[model samples]
Target chain A: MNNKLKQLDEQAVQYIAVGAAVLGTGGGGDPHIGKLMALEAIRKYGPVRVLSPEELADDDLVIPLSMIGAPTVMNEKIPSVQQMAMPLDLIEKELGRKVTAIMPIEVGGGNSLVPVLAAAERGIPILDADAMGRAFPESQMVTFYLDGIDCSPITMADERGNGVLMHAIDGIWEERMARAITIQMGGSASICDYPVSGAQAKQSAIPHTLSLAYDIGKTLFESKDSKQNPIEALLEQLHGYALFQGKAVDIRRRTEGGFTKGEAVFEGTDAYRDRMMRLFFQNEFLLATEEGKSLAVTPDLISLLDQDTGMPITTENLKYGARVVAVGFPCDPKWRAPKGLDTVGPQYFGYDVPYVPIEELAGGKGEKL
Target chain B: MNNKLKQLDEQAVQYIAVGAAVLGTGGGGDPHIGKLMALEAIRKYGPVRVLSPEELADDDLVIPLSMIGAPTVMNEKIPSVQQMAMPLDLIEKELGRKVTAIMPIEVGGGNSLVPVLAAAERGIPILDADAMGRAFPESQMVTFYLDGIDCSPITMADERGNGVLMHAIDGIWEERMARAITIQMGGSASICDYPVSGAQAKQSAIPHTLSLAYDIGKTLFESKDSKQNPIEALLEQLHGYALFQGKAVDIRRRTEGGFTKGEAVFEGTDAYRDRMMRLFFQNEFLLATEEGKSLAVTPDLISLLDQDTGMPITTENLKYGARVVAVGFPCDPKWRAPKGLDTVGPQYFGYDVPYVPIEELAGGKGEKL
Candidate 1:
C-alpha cells in the first residue's frame, strides 16, 4: 500500500466519522461502531479513493450497500461477514457481470461505513456518496428510488450460510421479503444490492458525499480541542439552521416485529422554554413538532444535540431531562421538488406543514416561509 | 372482450377465489376485494395464460407482483389502479429492458390474483407459478429469497401520487423502508415487486400454481353445492393431508402502524376436540402450536378455514366461537431442501421443529415428502 494512500485513508475515516455523526443528527444509531468498521476495513484494504459522481463511466455497475434491521438487534446480534457480500455475489452471478463500485445506501451511522468497509475489503472503489442525504427508515426513501431505479437482483444472506435472492417487481416487495428474512436471520443482516448503471448512479446518488463527510468529521473533531461550536460549525458546513432548542422530557419506545418505533417529548430550553416539542422515531427520527405545530419532517435533517457537549444523541439513547438542540438542514435540491415533497415531506408523514425551507425555519436570519 | 375469454376469466376467478380461500387458510386478508380487482383486470385485459415452469425460456425475465398492506385497509382503501404499475414501471425504466413474464409472489388470497391481474393489465404473460406455494408475511419468505436472490430494483407506490424506488443493500432494509413508507402512505399501499429470471423462476417458483388454484377453487365451490367436505376436497386437490380441526374460542387483536397482529385460541373440534391449539397471526397466520409444541412456522403454509363455508379467515376477521379447520399442506419440494428450509422452514420463524415434511406431518400416503 502506498504510504500516502494509507495516510489519506486514515484521514478520510476521521472525516467520515465526524460527518456521519453530524448527518445522523439525533438518531441513525451511534456512529462509533460504523466508524470502527470502516476504519478496520481501510486498515485491511489500504486507502480507498473518494470518487465523485462525475468519475463514474456510463456502463459501470454500482451497488448500494447497507445493514438492514432493528438497530437494537444490530447491537445484540453481530452480523456474519459472509452475509455482507451475499447480495453482491448473488447479483454478479445473476447478471453474469462484475460490480464496479460500492455505494452506501445512506450516510448515517452504520450504513455510511458498511459500503466503505465492504469496498475496502473487496478492493473495490466506493462512490463517495449515498442515496439519501440523511437517514430515513425505508428502502424506498432514496433519490434513486424517486428517480425510478430498480432494486432487484438484490440478495440477502445470513451468517449461517443461509441466503435469499429476490428480483422484486419493485422496491416494496424487496422490503417485504427482506424484512422477513432479516427477522429470521436474528433481526440483523448485512446487505449489498441495488445494482445501477453508472449513469443512473451519477444522476441519483447524492453527489460528493465523501468530501462532505470528511469535512464535517474533521471540523467536529478538530473543533472539540479548540472549544468550537461543533454543531454551529456543522450548520455552516451544511448550510443548515437550528430549528429548536430543548430538553428531552419524555420518551416512549416499542419494538414490533423487528422494528423500533417511539416518540421523544422535549420541553423547550432557551428562547423556547414553556413550549413543548415532540420528535417521533422509527429507527430514524421522522418528525418534529413544536407547540403542537409541525416543525420538520423527513427528507430534511433533524439533528438532536447535547446542549453542553454538542454531541449528537440517537433515538434509542434519548433520556429524560437531557438538554438538547434540534437543527434542520436542507436536503438536496432534488428532494424539495413536488415528487420529493410528496415523498419525504411532512404531509407524507401525516403532518400538515407545507415544507418550510430549512433556511426559513432557522432562527435569526428572518428567512421567511 | 372475447366471450370465450370472459368464460375462462370467470372460471379462473372462481378457481382462484376458492383456492385463495383455502390457500389463505387462516391469514391472507379477505381476497374478495382483490378477487374483484383481479376479476375486473382479467375481464379488461383478456385471459392470462398460466404457463408451467418448463415453458419459460432460460433467459426470460420473470417477476412476481402483489399488494402489501393490512387486508382490513385493502378492504376500505381500495388500491389505486396506478399503484400496481408504478414499481413495475420504475424497475423497467431502471433496467432499460422489457419484462418477459409475471408470476405470483404468494398464491394465497388477494395476493394470488395480484400478479395475474397486473400481467393482464400490463399485457405481459404470467407464469402459472409462485415463490411460496402459500402465503407468508414479509417479503423475504419466498423460494427465490431462499435461493439467495436479491429483492432490489423493488418499487413501492402509494395512491397519493407518491412512489418510492428502493435498491437497498439487503432484503431487510427493503422491508424496513417499505413498512415505514406503507404506514406513511395511509397504513397501506399497493405494491408490485419481485423480479426474477425465467430460469431461476422455473427453478424457484412453485410450478402449476394456476392449475392448483383452479382445482382448489373448483373443488371448494363444487363441494359447497354437492354437500361434500370442502376441507377434505381442498386437501385432496392439494394432495394435502389434514393438520388439525378446531373452533376458535378467543381472538385478541390491535392494529399497529398498519399491520393487524393478534392471537387466536382454538378449542379443537371434531377429531381435535378438547386439545387446545393456538395460532399467532400478523396479516397472515405465522405460527401455530398444540400443547406447547410448535406445529407450523413460516415459509410453510399455515391456514385457518371456516369449517362451514371452507372460506379462509384472515387474522383481521377472526371472531370468537368460529369453527375452523387448520391444515398444513406440502410445500414445494424445493422448500423442503435443507437450504430452503434454513431460509424459510419452521426454524426460520423461531420454531424448534426439525421441519417434518408436511406429508409426513399429515401422516398420509398422498403427496409423499
Candidate 2:
C-alpha cells in the first residue's frame, strides 16, 4: 500500500484488473477482456502515467471514461481503439479544451481499465481515482452525483462510428438518455461523462482507488505465489467478511433495459453445507441473502470469487456449478450517507430489502458467516 | 399559385397550416396546434422571412427543424418555445457556425410551422421547402435520404431542457437513435437534422412546398367563402382523386415505436353508399384499400378531410363516428423513384403491397369513387 503507483505497466494493469474485479462484485463487465484490451493498448502506446487527484491543478479538466451497457454484450463485442477514444475527442471538442487527465467513472474489472486504453492512446495521464469507489449499476450512483456535480456534455461512441454528445439536466437524466442510446447503439457503447474540474475531482471523487485496486490485486497474486490461501489473504487485506462458501446451483440472467439483470443462487458447501445463499444483481450485485436474512445489501460491496484461483467472477461469467466464495466489504463512507444510499440502495434497484452495513450484516468485520 | 410567398404572416401561417395538413396526409401532428404556435411566435417577434432555395447562397447553411414522435403524443405535449429552439442552438454549437436558414424536415401540419418558431426567434429566414414533400413516420423517409445525403449532426431537445447532439453514420442510424431519444423524451421532442448547404438543399429539397401548401389552404378557404364545394375546389386544385366518401365506422389507433400507428375503417356514404373502405397509417396515411383492392399505396399520398369544411384531419384527430372524404394525390415524382420507394414505400412500412401511382389507381385525375 505504501508503494503508490506512478504508472500503468503491464504488471500494474494485471494486478489492477484482478483487484478491480473483486471490487466489481460480479459486474462492471468481465475483467479478462478489459485486461487484454489494456495490455494491448499499453504494448502499442507505452505505459500510461498515473496521477493522484491532489497532483491535478484546481483548474484542470478531468473526464471519466468507460463502457456503458449490459456487461453480457460487452463480453462479446470488444470495442475498437477509435470507439474508446472518440468520446474523449468529442468531450474535448465540446469543452473547447484538452483533457488534463482521464479517469474511470467507477472502479470495476472492465471500467477501471477501460480508461487506460484511452489514456495510453491519448498520451494523457490517468488519474489514480474514480467517481465510484466500487462499481454500481447506474451512472448516477457516483460520488460526483452525491456531491451534486453537473453531468453534462456527456459523450458516447459505438464501434460503428456513431457518436453522441448530450447535455443532461442532471445525472439521473444522463442515465436515462445514455442508457437509451446505448441500447440503440447495439447494447454497448464507450462513454465519457461527469467531466469534472480537478478541484471538483479532489472534492468528490474517491481518491487513490487505482492504488487501492493495485494493492489488493498484488495481495491475491502474492498469496498465490507463496502457496497461501489467496481468498483468506484478500479478505484480510480488504477487512471483508466471508458471507458464504458455496457452489452455484442456479443463475437466471437476462439482458434487458440496457442491463444484465438477474440473480444467482448458491448451495452452501464445505464449512457451510446444506444452506443456500442468493445474490441479486442488475449489472452489479446489489444484495446477498441466506435463509431470509440479509447478508449484505447495496451501498455495501458483495463479490463472488472463484474458490480455487481467488479471481473474481462477473455477473456475466458466473455459471451454475461454479464453486465460489461470496464476500462483503464496507463501501466508501460517502455511500453510507443518506443521499448515497438513496441513489444506489437496494430499493432503488427494485429490491425489497433495506440497506444494511456489511459489518452489521456480518456481525463484525472479517467474520465468517 | 402565381404569388411566391416572401414572408410568413398571420394569414400565410393559417394557410400553410391547412395546406401542410393536406400534405401531412393525416400524420405530421395536428395543424391547429401548429397554427397557434406559429402565430404566437410571429406575434412575439415579427413575421418570419421566407427564402426560396434559389435565394439561398450555395454555401449557406440550412437546417431542417421539426417535431419527431407520435402525433398522438404531440397533440397533448405541446412544446415550449425554448424546446423548439434548443435543437437549433445545439446544432449550431455542434457545427461551429451560424445557421443561414431554417426549413421543415417534412411539410406536415405541425412540422411545417415548428421551424418558424425558431426562425422568427433567431431572426433567420425560413426556407420555402422541406426534405419530405409530405410527412412520413420515420425520420429517414426524406428526399435527402434518397439522395444519399448524410444525416449526421442531428440534434434534439426536450421540454425538460435535455439536449442531444448525435453524429449518425447514415440516415437510418439517425432515425434509430433520434427515435429512441424521442421516446425517452416523453414520446415527443423537437429536433434539427440534415444540416445541408444551400446547394444541397436546392438539389435534394422539394421546392416551394410551403407555397404549394399556402395555395391549397387559400383555395379551400376562398371556396368555403364563395359557398362552393371546398372539397371539389381542393380536388381540382391538386389534381387529386376522391377515393371514398364515408363515415368512420371503426378506428384502431395505438402509439408505439415512436409513431402513431393504426387503421380506420370507413363505411361508404353518399355517392359510394353500401361499400367499405379501409385506411392504414403510421403518422401519415400510407395505404387505402376497398375490398382488398389497393386504392392507393404509399409513395402516394392519402388524406382524410372533413366533408363539411375541407380542413384535413390528422391521424390523431380522426374519430370513430366522423363523416369524412378520403382523397388521394400523386406524391412528388422523387418519391416514385426506386430509392425513394424503397425507403418510404408500403413494403418498407410492412404493408406487403406494391407501390402504385395514385393516378393509375384513381383511373384519371379529379375522379370520384
Candidate 3:
C-alpha cells in the first residue's frame, strides 16, 4: 500500500470515529471496533477516498454494504475478515461487473464503518453518506426503498463459509429469505446489494455522512481534551437537543422469534430527577417515553451515552446503574415526507401520536436545554 | 370483462379456497374471506389463469403481490377492494412499465388470494406459482431470496388512499421500512411488488403451486363432502402426515411490533390423548412442539384446522374451546437445498433441530385408526 494512503487511512479512523459518533446522535453503537476495522483495512489496502455521490457517474455501479443479524451476536462472534469481502466478490462475479463504490446502509453502530472497510480492502472509494441517516433494525429502512430501488442479487456470507445468495422478486423477500439464512448462519452475516446508478445514489443517499461522523467523533474527543461539555458539544454540532438524562435501574430482555426485544427502565437523574423513563430497544433504540406519554420514537435518532465521557452505548450493552443522556436529532427531510412518515414515524411504532417533527416535539427551539 | 372468463372465475372460487387452504397447510387463516375476494375480482374482471413460469419469455415482467401487516387485523378490518390494486398501479406508473405477470411471495393465508384478485382486476395473467410454497410471517421469506431477488421497490397502500413505495438498498431494510409503513397504514396494508422476468420467475418460483393448492384443497373438500377422512385425504394429497390432534385449552397472546405472538396450549384428543402439543403463532403458525422439543418450524407449511369443517384457525382467533389438528407437510424440494434450508428450515427460525423431512418424521405412515 502507498505510505501516504496508509497514513491517511490512520487519519480517517480518527475522523470517521468522531464523525460517526456525532452522526450516531447518541444511538449508533460505540464505534471503537468499527473504527479499528476500517483502520486496519485502510492500512492494509491503501487509502480509500470518501467521495460524494455527485462525484460518481450516473451509471457507475455501486452497492450499499452492511452486516445483517443481531447486534448482540456481532459483539460475541465478530465476523471473520473474509466474510464481508466474500459477499461483495460474489456479487461482482455474478454480475460480471466491478463495483465502483461502497455505501453504508445506515449511519449507526458497526454499519458506519462497514463500507469504509469494504472500500479500503477492495481498493474502492467510499461514498460519503448512508441510505439511512440513523439506525433501524431491518434491511429496507433506507432512502433507496423510498426511491424504488431493488435490493436484489444480495449475497449473505456466514462465518462457516456457507454463503446464500437471494435474488428475490422484491425487497421484502430479500429480508425474509436473508433473515432465515441469518438465523441459520448463527445470526450474523455480511451483505452487499442494492446496486444503483450514481445518479440514483446521489439522490437517495444522505450526503457527507462520513465527514459528519468524523466531525461528530472529533468534537466528542476534542471536548474531552479541552475539558468542555461533550454532550453540549454534540448537541451544538448536530443542532440536536437533550431529550432526557437518567439512570437505568431495570432491564427486561427476551429473545422472541430470533429477535432481541426488551426494555430498560430508568430513574431520572440530574435534569430528569424524580421522574422515570422507559427506553425500549430492539436492534436500535426505538422508543423513549415518560410515564404513558410518548417522548420519541424511531426513524428519528435516539441515543444513550455516558454523561461524562460522551461515549456511546449499544442497546445490548445497556445495564442497571448506568447513567445516560438521551439525545434526539432531526432526520433527513426526505424521511419527514408523508411517505417517510408512513414508513418510520411514531404511529408506525404503535404510538398513537401524529407525526410530530423533532423540531416541534423539541419545543421549536431545536435544542432542549 | 371476458364473459367466458367470468364463468371460470365463478367456478374457481371454491377451487381457489381449496388451493389456498392446502397451500396454507394450516395457517393461511380462514380462506373464506380471501376466497370471496378472489371470486368477486374474478367476476368483475375475468378468469385468472394460473400459468406456469415456462410459458413466458425471458423479458416478460413478473411481480409478486401480497399483503403486509398483522393477519389479525386483516381478519377483522378486511382490506378494501382498492387497497389491493393501488400499490401495484402506483408502482407501475413509477416504473413506467407494463407488468406482465403477478405471483405470490408466500402461498399461505390471505396473501395467496390478494395477488389473484389483483391479477384478475388488472386483467393480467397470474403465475401458477409463488416464491415460498408455504406462508411465512415476514415478507422476505421466499424462493426468490434463494435466487437473489430483492424485496425493495415495494408499493404499499392503505385503504385510506395513502400509499408508500420504498426502494431500500437491501432486503432487511425493505422489511423495516415496509413494516413501519404497514403500522402507519393502520396496522395493515395491501402490498404488491417483487417484479421479475418470466425466465427468472420460472427458475426461482415453486412451479404450479396454484394447481397443487387446488388439488389438495379439492381432496379436503371432497373428503369432507363424502363424510370420509378429510385429514387423511389432505395428508395423501400433500404427501404429508399428521403431527398432533388436540383441543386448545389455553391461549396467551399479545400484539407486539404489529405481529400477534403468543402460545396456544393444546390437549391431545385422539391418538395424542392426554399429551400436550404447544403451537406458536405470529400471524401464521410458526412452530409446534411437544414437551419443549420443536416438531415443526416455519417455511415448512404448518397449519391447524378445525377437525370438523376443515376451516383454518388463525393464531389470533384461537379460543380455549377449539378442537384442532396440526399437520406437517414437506415443503417444496427446492426448500430442501442448502440455500432453501438456509432460507426456511427450523434453524432459520432459531430452532436447533436439523431438518427431519416431514415425510420421514411421519414415518411414511399418516394418521389412521
Output the number of the lDDT-best candidate: 2
lDDT tens string, model 3, B117-175? 77877678877778878777666667776677765566777775655554544565566
Ranking by DockQ: 2, 1, 3
Give candidate 2 misplaced runs (Cα > 4 Å).
none
Model 2 agreement with the true structure over A277-306: per-residue lDDT tens digits? 999999998899998899999989999988
Model 2, residue B116: distance off in Å is: 1.1
Give lDDT: candidate 3, residue B19: 62
- DockQ of each model vs. true complex: 0.06, 0.94, 0.04
**Candidate 3 deviant stretches above 4 angstroms:** A1-369, B1-8, B292-298
Inter-residue clash pairs, candidate 2:
A26-A315, B27-B283
CAPRI-style grade of the A/B interface in model 3: incorrect
Q: Please give, for residues B63-169, the per-residue lDDT of candidate 1 as tens digits.
A: 77777777767778776457778767766765678888877788776777777666778777777777777777677767777777778677766765555555555
| TM of chain B vs. native, candidate 2 | 0.98
Fill in the DockQ of model 3.
0.04
User: What's the i-RMS of each model?
Assistant: 9.9, 0.5, 12.6
- Comparing 1 with 2 on TM-score, the higher-scoring candidate is 2
Candidate of highest DockQ:
2
Q: Is candidate 1 or candidate 3 better by TM-score?
A: 1
| Residue runs of model 1 more than 4 Å from their true location after superposition | A1-8, A180-186, A268-276, A363-369, B1-369
